[model samples]
Target: KAAGSALMKNEKLVEDIIKSVVNAVNIPVTLKMRTGWNEENKNAPTIAKIAEDNGIKMLAIHGRTRAQKYNGDAEYDTVKKIKGIVSIPVVANGDITSAEKAKKVLDYTGADAVMLGRATQGNPWLVGQINNYITTGKTSKAPSLDKKISLILKHILQIHDFYGHKMGTQLSRKHIFWYSMHLDQEKGSDFWPNINRVSNHSEQYLKFHDFLYSI
Candidate 1:
């Protein structure tokens, strides 16, 4: 079973697994987990202590129960409670889409850091923006249309090289779809379907190049 299942609610099983993993690993071990199995069974604080006791060097908590999955707002109260009880570094995660939100979550939970997930899918520059805000108290400017197009092209070519033509061309479609959503909405909707149909890397590349430049 996944760790997010009943294992989260079973403190003994949680501790035993952590102990075994820590004892077996020569390198430092870190754990990433949701708050708990469900709202009523939230046992993250108990698990956090168990992790720290069993030699976990760091913990990253996504502030939602496994039942909640990707729905609803992430609550930081549980994360703050976990941080207070555990000496290990705690990373706050989930719903952290912007620099301001990252700062807010860190300040609220007193976590050592924040982790960004789905939000960075099409907007990788968000990492730099967040870093700039955290370090300099200034937000980085959004990338220009040309810059976005350049990155999309570069990213697509790299994907092609890494995965080879057949699989690379298949994998690149999702990225193209994501990048398109960040651009012209109407055009992107129209363009993605056609791009999705292209089977070859060269054709996919040319279509993306023409569509982006045309916009």
Candidate 2:
């Protein structure tokens, strides 16, 4: 959602955010933003100072403008320049995947860190893998079948409990799709039948259990 023109144009929202959040908490303040609103209004540097001056401790910039949507290559040059202009730590985000890509982004953008988004879907251990490779030169072995099943079941239970049987069950379908899509050919097809039949929370759990027992 777009902010009102007055609020977006005032340019003091950054400082105000730092003031309010910094005053309200004892922890460090961090700001996340796009590459300004659009091309001609690339005011991240100006916003960065407002944050820094008002007590923000770190900044994260996604490498895209409002006009780009998710199209085209993410522009790291703006992120690189923001790192140069800001005194606080800067983190880069947008379409980052793999350890080598992470390394390349940090180097190219001169960011203090890289923020992983969609690439971490069903691959939560990615951060650990990249961190291990960067610090120890090795990625951990992939999770075994038993571990994968355990994680899927646990996640389903948590979602069901949090959102209740109805909404939680509805929410779990996508998660189930994500978890089961990587199974080997025979089991993959078997899993799809169970997933598609799910209509409610109890059915989802039952289907999941049935698929697991089949494995």
Candidate 3:
């Protein structure tokens, strides 16, 4: 019905869409897809071939079916299969939360790279850590508590400046929640509840500043 995995149900349609997009674009075309619509219909292999044949330059596959959504563990056997069947560069995505996990996914799936998503929500340094571990075999130290607080406050300020106070205050809540996940739980519990109620940028900023320093 929609324009995503639902389209995967019809192979001819998938091919037509891919060909159309590839022909319409001057830039290299890429595809990001799930394994399939459900457990019984994992057509990623078939779709991957269709995409490559239609001139898709690269692929990134999240190792879960559309039905599975974000609920269970992500499987890589399908991704491994896709990599083996396709000559184009493939990047593996899903549940790559740590540097070791990133390397393991790449090694296991033979993917060209691993994409980080939810794990990087508040921890931007995770990318550097993964790169360092992949290239140097060393884990980068986590930022100090003070450093985390500074970054969180700076991020909130930037959001406020960019989107103005109303929308920025609303948007900053999720980032704050994610960043707080790395901090003391008791303090986070208190801070989040209080911050969630604040509707103004200045008050939100002041409360966050006070909360972070209070830790």
Q: Tens-digit lDDT track for model 1 on 99-206?
A: 999988988999999999888887888988998898898888878989888988999999999999999999999888877776777898999878898998999999
Backbone clash pairs for candidate 1 read none
Minimum summed lDDT over a 10-residue window in model 1 is located at 1-10
Query: What lDDT would each prediction earn against the true structure?
Result: 0.89, 0.77, 0.90
Judge candidate 3 at residue 131 and give its lDDT.
94
Per-residue lDDT for 1-215 in model 2, tens only? 44522233447665675688899999987888777767788777777778788888898888877667678877888889889988899999988878878888988988999998877765666787778777777767657878877887899999999999878988887777666655454676667776765677777887787686567
For every candidate, C-alpha RMSD to the true structure in Å: 1.7, 3.4, 1.7
What is the lDDT for 90 in model 3? 94
Per-candidate TM-score against the hidden true structure = 0.92, 0.80, 0.91
RMSD of 2: 3.4
The order of the candidates by lDDT, greatest first, is: 3, 1, 2
Q: Give candidate 3's whole-model lDDT.
A: 0.90
Error of 2 at 133 (Å): 1.3
